[model samples]
Target: MKIVQISDTHLTAAGGPTEEGFRLLVRHLDEDVRPDLVVHSGDIQVLDPDDTADRVRSRELLDLISTPLLVVPGNHDVGMPGLNAWAGITVTDARVAAHVAVFGPDHWRHETDEAVLIGIDSELLGSGLQREADQWRWIEDTVADLPVRKPVLLFLHKPLWSATDEPVDHQVDVGPVARDRLLGLLERIDLRSVGCGHLHRYRQVRRDRAIEVWAPATAFLAAGEDSLPDGRQELGYVEYTVEGGEVTAQFRLVPGMPQITTDDVPSIAQAIEAMTALR
Candidate 1:
């Protein structure tokens, strides 16, 4: 099966470069690379988790894709799970519910004749919410009930670990506690790959037996002080071809898609300002 993974669209109600970039991506998907399914690895909004209009606008833009779509929540969609959450907007029950109201469930599973696809809400990890516990149970139960030796492909918003050997940063990747728990649970299954997006860059890392694929943002590039440590800062998505319990990923970009930065757009800059002011 051919599956396309897109991440960090960051669509806003106020039309801008990010929106334009997504439009170009949609066109690219519809015309050039038609895949069996499309999965959004999240950050579906510009910055605010409380703004319903932004959520609606994101949904509208995502609806442009004609392929079947699955989405997971990003920090921007439902906030992070720590004291240093951006703009003091931490993940909460209400925020998660709001995201679920627009997009379906924050976590889900899709089964194909050849493989099992699981998408989880990485933002909920370490949040210490009842939902987090519930998700853990669901993950364990789901994996346990799967047929023996079924190849599992996992998807989430944040990377399980940082690209470098540095300690886990809650701001960029999953926390150590949650990561350990997840890794332990995943050991029981035949995990083929883990697909993620949040760094706004494209990268591929091999850990143990699984390949971790990070899809680039469909919106703007990370620049200046916000630049990521490693990976190609480009505008595109990830295309995965899976067959016979094996998968190969290729990064694809659309022609004429501008490689702009967050500072180049007024709407993004204003949104950053508003988020900072909240602190």
Candidate 2:
């Protein structure tokens, strides 16, 4: 199976260069990397978590892609726990339901002859909510039922960590509590790789038998000093192939997409004010 992973497109209803970047990505997918399935790791929209109109516009724009697509939420698409509240948005059940109402499910599973693809809402991991525990059970049960020989590819919105021992930054990656539980779960599963976005840069690391792939953002690059060591602050997506239960990944920079600095985007406060006005 051939899969393309696109993350952090951050397209907004108010059309701008961010939306143009996604348009370029779709064109590239059509003319070049035409894969069997597209897995959007997250951050499908820009700035607003509860904007149903943004979700509606995103759904319409993403529909331009003809390939089968699956998506999971990012902190931007749905509010993340212990985060975003300062901007006047907090993650609520209705907010998550809003995303599902527009984009299908916040998490899903798909099986191919050679591999199993699972997308989970990473925001739920450290939330300490009932849904978080429920998702863990679902993952464990689902993986337990699968054949031991089948490779499993997991997708989420944030990287596991910059390094295995990196300090926990709740905003950047999974926190300690979620990390410990998730790592324990992976130790028991036949995981081929874990793919994530949210950093805006690209970094890949290997943990025991599984590879962790971080696809670059299609919208912009991470600004100064924000990138992890040995990480590339580039603008692009990832393409991978699964054959004989083995997975190989390639980073394909979307040719000619204009690169924008983080300064070009609105601040959290500005975004919140803008979204409030929209409502």
Measured by lDDT, the strongest candidate is: 1
TM-score of each: 0.95, 0.90
In model 1, pairs of residues that clash are none
- For candidate 2, list the clashing residue pairs, or say none: none
**RMSD of each candidate?**
1.7, 3.1
Cα deviation of 187, candidate 1, in Å: 0.9
Worst 10 residues of 2 by lDDT: 161-170
Cα lDDT for residue 30, candidate 2: 87
| TM-score, prediction 1 | 0.95
Each model's lDDT comes to: 0.88, 0.80
Worst ten in a row by lDDT for model 1: 161-170
